[model samples]
Target: MAFADACNWINGNVNSNLTNRNSIQAICYSDVKSQFGLTANHVVRACARVAANRLTAKRKRRKVREFKPTSFDCDARTFRIIEEGYLVSLSTTEKRIKVPMRVSNYHIGKLQGRPSTSAQVCKHRDGNFYIHIQLKSDAPKLKKSKNVIGVDFGRRDIAVTSTGNSWSGKDISSIRDKYFRTRTSLQKKASQGTRSTRRRAREILKRLSGGEKRYQSWLNHNISSSIIREAIATDSIVAVEDLTGIRERTNQKPRNKTERRRSNSWAFYQLRAFLEYKGIKEGVKVIAIPPSYTSQTCQKCLHIGTRNNKSFKCENCGNNCDADYNGAKMIELWGCSVNQPRGSELLSCDINSRATESLHLPYRKCR
Candidate 1:
């Protein structure tokens, strides 16, 4: 009840223009404490801080109209993690409380010897309270490797590497299609069925929600693991495309219903995120480069080419190859140029001279 009142107070005061933490605290701290009857000044301040955080994060797209009472945000003065005792101490409206934590072996190992000052106490959907402790550590230095592995993300094949490795997207597409059909049918029944039938349909829909997403997340984890393992085995740095806002861009193009659904469902960003975190944890370097012309440029001739469906044909050098494989190779070349600009400058000049001579065009020095 106290937490709910605090959230209401914070929400009433927080607005789009005034989200700065210190400013909000200065304005609302005393009022929040008096209105909510919260004894701890830190608790009121924490509520204000959380409200500020939500507004500032993704500020352009998201707004914090209300704060849920399901969770409490704690700062250094309000929370402590006792690793030896396997417990978390958190401040409440009335008093401070110590709660025992049950953790997995993985979490136990990670929390060992890590100093944590802040934590969140939240209620899960399963009706249990859990404490999430934030762990901080400096990232290890990235390993230096002359070898580079390029990855091409696509719809047909999820990920294609420069080294002839590929993970097909057929299984994921099929799974998504099946789930879509099920969800559509259930939604129709939910809207236009008898009262009892509608209730059951809604229950089933609730249970089915996030099922496909979980499967996709699991598959991405495996794919990222394999890519990181291959990178480690070959002592190579991984290079991928910087595909931010790709969905929005692709959606702008003309497409049928099924094509649009497939395009929207692609989880390339999630796969990339998995690759990055796994690479960081495994001490492998992963980088993203521009995706411009990777598919249209020939890897051998470095000239614009024709891509038809799954195949690529280069008119300049008469090179014929798989489109995805060619893109991966071009990505590798681009990655090498970016990774070792000083050394690749001479190579770039040589390739440019050859290309210009073959086309009967004047060559300019690459600087």
Candidate 2:
């Protein structure tokens, strides 16, 4: 009720008339507090939050929509963490309620004996309540490394590293296929005549989707951790492809239905994000470079190559190599070239130049 009132106030006054939070508060505070039985502080916080959101959306050239039905924001001052991080006291319209939280040691470590700035209380589609807390911490100083490791991300092999190691996507692909098969069966049942059968099928479908998401998240965490560990062991900076606008690009290409579905469902960005934050915590540099021709360009000769399935055959040098491994090497070379003293000269050097020849020496072996 308080959230709806705040959204109403913002839509009616602040967004429409460009009025300030103070003016809006003066106009609606008393009425909102009286009608919703909310404290004065809650009303003020809600107004301020809505106004701030409006300002941010305007700056970003985005349209600000009203709050959804399932979530609400709570100011840090209005909530208290007590009982050794096991309980949270939240303020509501009638009275304060203490909610028990099942927190892990990982979360406790992240808190680091400091209170969170604020929290969002949300109800998931599966009918579960969750609290997301935001905290502030200083990042550790990055460690300097003399080596660079390039990572090639793909659907067949989840990640291929310059160190001649790869994480396979077989398990992830199999799980996705299994989910699709199960959902297809459920859909047939859902189209039956009985209402109860349809309702049951829908519930099962929702649960299956949630389970698939959790499993994928686990796989990504393990893969990212292994990649970071390899970089730390070698004291190397991690280089990856900047896959921005990849979905749009993929959508533009011609593909069959199954291939298109697989392309759209892959979680490349999530894995990248995991690598980035984990890299930061481990004091390793993770950089993203434009993936213009990382796969098509030969890592050994820098010549254009034709890829047949997983094999890459260099047109000029006749060098045969694994396509993903070759891409990883090119990414690594690019990383090294950009970090050198004469970076631009190295970057724009001809494929037959002495500098390019020397750069190929380190990563010439085929995996």
Each prediction's Cα RMSD?
4.8, 7.2
Predicted candidate 2 versus true structure: per-residue lDDT over 87-197, tens digit per residue: 988988878999998888897777657878888788987799998887777788887765889999999999999889998988888889888889899999989738999
Q: Residue 172: error of model 1 in Å? A: 1.2
Candidate 1: tens digits of C-alpha lDDT, residues 91-191: 76668888888988998898898888667778997989887778778777788887889999999999999999998999999999999999999999999
C-alpha root-mean-square deviation, candidate 1? 4.8
TM-score of every candidate:
0.82, 0.76
The candidate scoring highest on lDDT is 1
| Candidate 2: residue 290 Cα off by (Å) | 1.9
* RMSD versus native structure for model 2: 7.2
